[model samples]
Target: MASINVDFSVGQGAISSRLYGAGLEHVGASVYGGFWTGPARPGDESRSAPPVHIGWREDVLTLARALRPGILRWPGGPFSQSYRWRDGVGPRGDRPLRFDHYWAKPEPNHVGTDEFLDLCRWIDAEPAITVNTRSARPEEAAAWVEYCNGSMLTSAGALRLANGQPNPWNARLWSVGSNNWDMGAPEAARRHNLFARAMRGVDPGIELTAIGGNPSNQSEWDKVVIGQTAEQFRHLGVWAFDGVASVEGDNPEDLFHAHVASAERILWTISNAAYRLDEMMLNGGAYVGVDGWGIWKQSRQGLQHDYDMSDALIAATVLHGLHRLAPRVGYAAWGNLVNALGLIQATERACWATPVYHIMKMFRDLHGTEATRCTVAGPAVAAPGGNSPVRSSRPPYKGMALIDASASRDVARGRYTLSVVNRSFSDRHDVEIDVKGLPTGIGATSHLLRAESPFAANSAKEPRAIEPFVFPIGQIPREYPFPAHSVTVLIWEETPGLT
Candidate 1:
């Protein structure tokens, strides 16, 4: 049994809905065979134009809607560095299936600016466009921003009108790619400033995301890029793919636990960057954007990570941590939304929700407006040491608490959501959550996500093998049993009194 104390009064800033962002890039089948597969079916209605319908897979679209993604990033990861916006905006047949430098395959410019914006509109998600800082000039990058958010009088806006978007896209988060190693930090910082100037000059109000490299190599990129161009960007975009650089061994269990345990590294990277930005004091309002995050492994399917329950635990834990961090961490986007490192997998036969999709759907659909601090005192489990999952330079830990948790509340304070994860491989936890300032005997219910083993994965044929189920928590201040290797999300209203 465990006693978890949650103080409603103390925590970080209010949670932004953008914290639950999803990335859509042209890596592998992420665009080609994934979100933008097949031809436009009869019922495919474009919400933006209403008259013009385009390429999209219905099954993938349906799953995306259910995921409740708040923000959508596009173009590429490494592909962003190589993509050109101009090639994609004009006509369909006129668009070429150019040989992409990053993925080393032909990228058909099907789901470009227009289709992507329409997607954001259909799914009710804010648009976050990325500018190609490397290979593409500052002017080209600026024109793309103008094409998305400028007035009718602007040249790019006129071009946009000719291209069928009469209304400005008014896209929110504007990113300048995250591949920062080409020119080194100093040169990259300079180039970032140049692109930022041109893009912001076109639309002064547009928010920008600067490259804040992956956690393993962040030290070389973050402080320099952030310090040199703090005024240029609103969020430091960090690509956090936590797992083995390559799947180290045959034992999936070892890699699974290692993946679960290393999830903390995601939060740590954000926290560390946030602290550095705070220390810099140049950009007081800067937020750390989890530009792309998930487990990185050497799967047979290339970067298309076949996510299992282990990845779900990482997703849930990282989300809870991001919630607790609040405004400090901004725009946490899952790497690619369709195939390569995506939440939902798309194939020619059918599309199905990966285990990560269910976890994301649950947390997003039942997201909290406010964050609160919580402490867990529970049974301990030995954390994996050595380098089975991924090599870690940090010293080995004594043990990890079986239960990891975070607290969230509705804006009105009448309702609260507590997400608890049981990291134990075989032991369920009976935990008592002490919610201070909440009343007694209020009604409560819970959502649980679990399976027989963490290694169990979901595919098109067996999507329901691992999923979330809703149950009634009955009352507040009661001992709840959280299943082993599971995520338990509880929601309750407060009546007057203590637990």
Candidate 2:
């Protein structure tokens, strides 16, 4: 039998809701076709913010509201390299059409700055904008910031008013370019400082992020960039991926290992940088932001993924890892939210939730203000396969623990959420969950994320093929059965003064 222990007194760090955020890039059908399925009624003159002229798919909006990603990044991943803020704004008909250099497609610039912010509001998410550090100037970035956040007296803010928005969006989170391209650390720092100084000069309260480069040369890049511009940046931004083209076969077990390996690599990257931040930014807040992260299966359509139950388990593993490394990891956003690597797949008339969507949505309730300690001791399985990364080497984990778990406590409400992952290929494990220093037996239940086959996925036709099964219960059990390759979340009801 597997044994799991959760100690409520042993607090890990506070968890930020942004850690469960998802990003939207202007790649493939993610934006134009998937997110902004145009033609809702024109902008409402009465409302403070509206999707002017352009329309949205009601089905997508309804589903997105339920998913409720805490943060949503806009504009680009690499597409931001060449994206011009000026062209995306103004009248919908007049906005110039630009060729998306990264995706090599024509972008109509319909869902520009204003529309994206409004979309975020509809879905109840905080908006995060990216600046074009490589292709655009510092002044241009400052202007974009001013347009979104500055007072009505400012020129950019005045332009925003003329464009239909009555008040400022006041977007707080901003990140500079990742992957310095041709420029080395020194040059990247200089450019970042220029942008930071200009942007911060406009709004002193805004939080700024600087790129920590890719894994291949991350350490040296961190030294140079952090060494030079430590005072200017609020967080170091990084991206992680574990899927490769070769792993796109029929091996469900291999896919499970590859994704778990990806989770390990992500935590490793955060831990590696946390060490430096501790030494460097001692006086200030220390946190890292994973703005874009997901599996990078080398599909014909760039980073698009046909997500399945296996992918859902991997998503839970990654989220659990983030919970374990709280406060250190400030934020994380799943790569693409709509189409072409999306959690919810959409068509013109209808939309449906994917298996990954169920996991992400279910995991939302598991995270609270504080993280608690949870450890698992059990038999191990040999993880023979490896995943090829976009920048770094394979994961260092040789074998895997049969049971992996993490816990979070809402100190204010006296409620606790615990998650356990059973990574076995075939057999189920009956586990002992020992709770300490907290009262259980108060209203509690378990929700399991599992399917008959790891390869099972949700599509437009069978949207509910693989969904969370909520077990009827009165009190939480000490020993529970965890199915093979599944994630189980157990939540306790709110208790007064439990903290």
Candidate 3:
């Protein structure tokens, strides 16, 4: 049996909602068949088409709106490194169809800066754009900031007005390129700092993010970047992913715990970086961005993943871990939004949410403002290694409990939410959540996400194959039985103490 102790009085900083962010890139069908429709044919030069008039799917937009993503990272993964922003802007008819060198696909260039910012407005999500510092010049990056957030009197702002938008989009977060190594040549950290300075000269209010290594692996690089260029940026980017494939004949349950350990390593890295930044006395508080993260064991030409029950459990645990590490992490985008390693799968006629999508929505909507400290006390299990996509840098194997849990508190709203991830394959653990230093709750609701088999996944025909089910539970019992390989979120009303 596993027991969770949640002490509301013992908490870290406020959990940032932006940690539950999503990203969009010009990869595979993510842009072509995922967001747009009505054919990729050349448009009539006479018609002067803006993206709003272009075939953006209402059904997909409806699904995107449901997640209520806090922020949307635009125009890349690798695409940002070579993305030519000027080519994608202005008249849609004049925009050229260029070859995306990164993904080796023909980019239609229909969705540009304005279209992406417009989509953000429609969904009410903050725009987090990554500037090109590899193929493009620093001037181009500055011009992009001006076009998005500059005043109407400026030259780029006039072009934006001429293009159609009268007001500035006012995007806040600007990522100054990604990891780039020139085949054993010079790295791009210094170039990244130069671009950051130029972009800031354009809009001093925008938050700049610099590309760096994961918290644990890059000791020297982290020290140099934070010590040298820490004044130029406010956040550092960290990318992480895992595969559920069997390693040394390990089972799916072992893979699930390994993912948890990997996420914990990411948190540790972020905390270490934050401490380093503080010691240097940087101009601003530097946080971390887990910008690219996912669990993909399967891939196709477009990197499609049929997320299974085990993936859903991993997603829940990862989000739970992020909530606990709120003091150092301010943003996270779930690698992608559609087509390639996405939460929702798209086709010509229909779009459906995956098991990962349901779990993401559950945590995003149910999470609160503050993280409540939780400790899991139970018999430990040895977690196997080799879950990460990168070799030779797998998370260290440690004794982990079968139950992993995190809790959040909304003091203003008088609500507390607790999420538990059960990684055991066979044994059912009786989880007793002891609430201390808090008033008793009057009502409670428990939502459970589980599948008959760990490998069960959802298809278009069976979209709800692995979805969450809600049930009203009895009085906060001494202990509750949590089945093997399941995730449960319990929401209850707490009586607020007198101020």
Best by TM-score: 2
Residues 271-345 of candidate 1 have per-residue lDDT tens digits of: 887877777855388888877887765454467468888778888889988887787887888887887888888
What lDDT would candidate 2 get against the real structure? Answer: 0.78
Ranking by TM-score: 2, 1, 3
Give the Cα RMSD of candidate 2: 4.1
- lDDT of candidate 3 over 17-132, digit per residue (tens): 78878889888888777777643346633443223234677767787888877788988668888888988899889998899888998987888999888888887678899988
Give the candidate number with the greatest lDDT.
2
The local distance difference test score of each candidate is 0.77, 0.78, 0.76
Instruction: Evaluate residue 162 in candidate 2 and report its C-alpha lDDT on the 0 to 100 scale.
Output: 91
- For model 3, the superposed segments whose C-alpha errors exceed 4 Å read 38-54, 181-187, 214-217, 250-272, 275-284, 302-304, 386-396, 494-499
What TM-score against the true fold does each predicted structure earn? Answer: 0.91, 0.92, 0.90
How high is the lDDT of residue 120 in model 3?
A: 84
Clash pairs, model 3 backbone: none
**Number of clashes recorded per candidate:** 1, 1, 0
Sorted by lDDT (best first), the order is 2, 1, 3
**In candidate 2, residue 61 scores what lDDT?**
74
State the local distance difference test value for candidate 1: 0.77
